[model samples]
Target: MGEFEFLAKLRERLPPDGPQVKLGSGDDAAVTAPAGATATSVDAIVEGVHFRRGEAELRTVGRKALATALSDLAAMGAEAGEAYVVLGAPADLGEEDFLALLDGMLELAAETGTTIAGGDVTRAPALTLAVTVVGHAAAADAFVTRAGAQPGDLLVLTGEIGAAAAGRLLLEHPALAAELPESTARELRRRQLDPMPRLRTGLALAGSGATAMIDLSDGLAADAGHLARAGGVALQIQADSLPLAAGVAEVAAAAGRDPIELAVAGGEDYELLAALPPDRLVPASDASGEAGEAKLTPIGEVVVGEGVEIRLPRGGQLKAAGFDHFAGPERGSQPEARERRGG
Candidate 1:
């Protein structure tokens, strides 16, 4: 179908605008009335660099594009609000493909009470999606930041890590699926293709006195470094304490890699990692449990130092490296100097 025709279909499929949105799509700009504070983030995924369209359904891709972008809002402990999307369609796309993708995104928007306020479509060399999400909070201080971690604060993590990375490995090397149960392999693939943002848990942590927070899109090792750099502190993570998904070890072993390294260096888990006061640990865990979100686990602590140090249970330290967006297929680590400092 043509661009205008697809847009008309999108408008027809969208649900009623949320309370925060004054005007929805089909305008030059979307109008929104913020209650108090707002946190905005933008993220994009490209076909080859982010995903191989051949391996995933268009619907799943749509969900992932929006979910990944909203993860930023979750990290800030903000309530999801509105989303603006930009879809770049390749020449081979058809009407059914477009609607299927929109249906996926609309489903997620409804689930999160987010309004699809505005967007644009264009021809591109590859299938591309860019999503911009705005999240709301009572005040600026209500939203946690990476820069707010304090010395002696306890580091907490939501859900488990390495599943998405393992999922990617499975997708890229289908032969490795023989190493895991069928269900486990499918779940791992789902983890990579359709990650959910930790919205409720983020709000719970924010309410429970979390001082600093970030989502694990770029693996624990790299993102922990980001938090440490932002807060000007050190993150001492116990390797044994990391919560690994059930099939991560199997997949890692089959792939001839360390499960801990996969958990540390793998990206796209989309779970929340936060720094909370010692006294707030129980409250935070309870809050997350009451919300029926992922289990909260204490994996480390913040100290008065500069880099991130992931201590292995046996000995030595884990050299963590996360996904590099611009680094082609052979993604490398950050500079030695910055990595040494844990940034």
Candidate 2:
């Protein structure tokens, strides 16, 4: 199909526009009316660098491309509004594959109550998806940022970690799944392929007096560093206090890697991490469970220092590798692209 023909197909399949959107899709620019404030973020995933098309369904890839981008808005405690997608399709992509990809994003957009407002399509050497998302809030101050953390604030994380990293390991070395239960193995892979953004949890925390917040996209250790640096305070995370996904230890052990390291440095959990006042813990936890079905775990504290320190239970510091997009290749880093290879 031609580009315009494909776009027409997309318009037919897209969900109805959200409340904020005045004009959506098939226009030179999308029209949105906002009452207060807006938060925007963009993310892109490539065929080999971010995912292997051979291993993942086109629908899953579409979901992930949109999910990860929305995660940034979630960190800011913004309500999902609308999405603009830029899709680069290689010549070989069939019509069914293209629609499959769009269907995935449509599914997630409907679930999040977000509208697919507008986007552009083009030819490329690889399958590429870039998503721009805008979220809504009552006011600018109503949304949380990483710089708002204060000393003596408690550090809390929504949902567990290390599952995506373990999932990556299983994908790279399928033999590791032998020791884990079938369901556990399936869940680990799902965590890597279809991570859910903690949107409701973020909204609850923001309303519950959260001072600072971020999504765990680049692993806890690296993302915590970002939070600490932005807030100009030190973070002391207890190694033993981290909530690991059910099969992380098994997958890590079978792969001859440290479970804690995987949990700390394994990227793409897509969970929210926030700094909260001590008094807000109960309300935050209660609200988070009620809104998102996620439990808030107090993992650490902000202190009068700089950088992040992961304190081991036995009185030592644990070193973990963190994902960096522009850095040189390193083991356990760049979970999204660690196993990247051309099709």
TM-score of each: 0.95, 0.96
Q: List the candidate 2 regions with Cα displacement exceeding 4 Å.
A: 330-343
Cα TM-score of candidate 1: 0.95
lDDT of each candidate versus the true structure: 0.89, 0.89
Off by over 4 Å in 1: 328-343
TM match of model 2 to true structure: 0.96
True lDDT of residue 282, candidate 1: 99
What value does the lDDT take at residue 139 in candidate 2? 96
Clashing pairs in 1: none
Question: What's the lDDT for residue 253 in model 1?
Answer: 94
How close to the true structure is residue 32 of candidate 2, measured as C-alpha lDDT? Answer: 94
